[model samples]
Target: MKAIVIGGGVIGSSIAYRMSEAGADVTLVEARRIGGGTSSTSYAWVNACEKLTSRAYFELNWAGVKSHRRLAEEFEGSNWLHRPGVVQWQGAGAEAAGFDEGDFDKLERLKEWGYPAEKIDTQTLAELEPDVDLSTFNPEGAIYYPEDGWLDGPVYAGAMVAAARQRFGLKVVYGQVTELLTRNGAAVGVKLANGETIEADTVINSSGRWANEAVGNADHELPLAPTVGLIAYTVSGDTSLRHGLRTPLVNCRPDGAGRILLRANDIDKTLPFDTEAVPSNPAAQELLDRVTQLMPALKGVHVEAVRTAIRPIPADGYSAIGPHPALSNYYVTVTHSGVTMAAFIGEGVTDEIVHGKSVSEFAEFRLSRFF
Candidate 1:
């Protein structure tokens, strides 16, 4: 079947890779460069621990973590994927923001569910993260997930696209898909902004923050409440932070060779959604201060860049997959935790598209609910 996959972020890249693996004639399209959207600004933390809502969602992400490990092993030479573990701590500031209870409760629940979790004291925490200044934000204890890790999203996505094209003869079309061509109430192909038209048997909309607009191209509504997040990158400094750290004030992980990525939940709200522009000067300075407070090793480091990106979240704050009732041959795959869930979703979506076999795990995330 001729399949058109929209969006070139990690999720869309994965879908294209899996589709090609399943022997489908796939054409991956991206408006901008691949992984330039939410995937680029993502924290890229590979974890199921953050899924505090649905057990199925948690399971899906947990599976994604495993899939990533296998993928890393398959591409053993790639240095972008790392499973250095992740540390999460709650502090007085988090409690003041009313985030302590839910965060702590999620940790406890994960342990009960047989997930490997460790509650470490100051001494143990120091051993795990030697460069961190415990004196700055000392806590009673912190939860550690030894299975968690992180990846460079854009790098991974670009690699996947390359693999799909090289191994499976997949074609990648670059340009904006301005409209979804339809016939007899079914999606048949896409019309690009440059006036080129390509026919396809199926169209998969994996268009991150622009998913709602992609859906609207077919004149159908896909409810998406896209939110913006600010991610600041600093030139890598001398640091012994070997693991991903998610603190009350900052969530950070290593990026590239000598760089660190920083973000905060509250900081995301200060920026506007869908703005490709860099964060304002004040926002950038505030982020740098927050990062310094969380990791003193980064004190002298300069803010290389701050990206304001719109997160791809469905209206109900859940993954929306499967074909919509109003349109035929058009499938959607969108979620808040796309980084954590991309691998599993990609493989699952491939199965559905190729063999017409729907995976049971995706039952809760289908698009039928929106109808």
Candidate 2:
């Protein structure tokens, strides 16, 4: 069977690798180079905090996180793995009603996933993190997730691409899928930018932000939305900032590097991808100033890198990862957390396409959920 995947980011590469791993003829199309989109600009945080608000999202992401852990070990030779604990910071009353410590049900939901969190006292927090000064922190406490952290985003995508093409014998096409070719309301193939048409029995819409466009959805039936995320690296290279000290994965307060990797709550949401946007957000600037108060080491750090990429956000607060409603042969798998959930998302999609297994955790995440 021939399967064509759109997008060469982590999600596309992952699905390509898994499909080829299951003995399918897989071809991936990318408008740009591999890992060159949001995946490239990703300031990844792979903590199990994606579903902190809802119990179900928490469970799904927790499962995805565990899958990532196993894949990290399985793909250890790629050197895309890192074990840095995620530090969730909250100010004043935010902690009480925040992503870190919002609800007791959320904690209970997390407990089922084998993630036991604890509130850290100020003195204990200071002892554990001597570099941070919580003088400005007015939170009741902070939650620590020992299993959460970040990784080399591009390296992971490269590793998946290598495994798919070299090991699994998948075809990696360095082009864009301009349109989805259909026959009798069923997807048959895709037309590339070079006008080359390749027949495909299954066309997976794994494109992160451009899936709908790839499938010719001018009406926008899907609930997908994009938000710009900015990444700023520090030139000082403070070793104190190496522990993956982050706030909430969806959206939290400023981080230790004096550079806030804004979460979903702080999302600069807008439709249609825009890269020419400037780096001037009052909230982000405030984040930088506040982070220095917490970590004095960032007082003199130079900004190393600053880039913006559109993050896909589903309306239901979950990813759309399955076959199309009317066209099952044409599937879609996308999310803002693709960096964190790529491994699992790939595994699940491959299971359905190659092994005929259903992803129970995300049954509602399919496009059929809306229709």
Candidate models: Cα lDDT each: 0.81, 0.68
Q: Which parts of model 1 are misplaced by more than 4 Å?
A: 95-104, 216-219, 274-280
Q: How much RMSD separates candidate 1 from the native structure?
A: 2.3
Model 1 Cα lDDT, one tens digit per residue, 40-101: 87888887777757788777778777777777788758766788888888765553221254
Q: Could you give candidate 2's per-residue lDDT for residues 1-371 as a string of tens digits?
A: 89998887888888888889999999888888888878877767676664565555656677777887888788756576566565555643343222544444445555666785666667766766677776754356566777677656678888888888888788888777878888887889999879999889999887787776776656334776566666544444443444555443223223344444433334334323453433354434544565566667667654444567777777665778787777658888877677778888889888988898898877767777766
TM-score (C-alpha) between model 1 and the true structure: 0.93
Q: Identify the leading candidate in terms of lDDT.
A: 1
* Candidate 2 RMSD to the correct structure: 3.6
Shift in Å, residue 285, candidate 2:
4.1
Estimated TM-score for each candidate? 0.93, 0.87
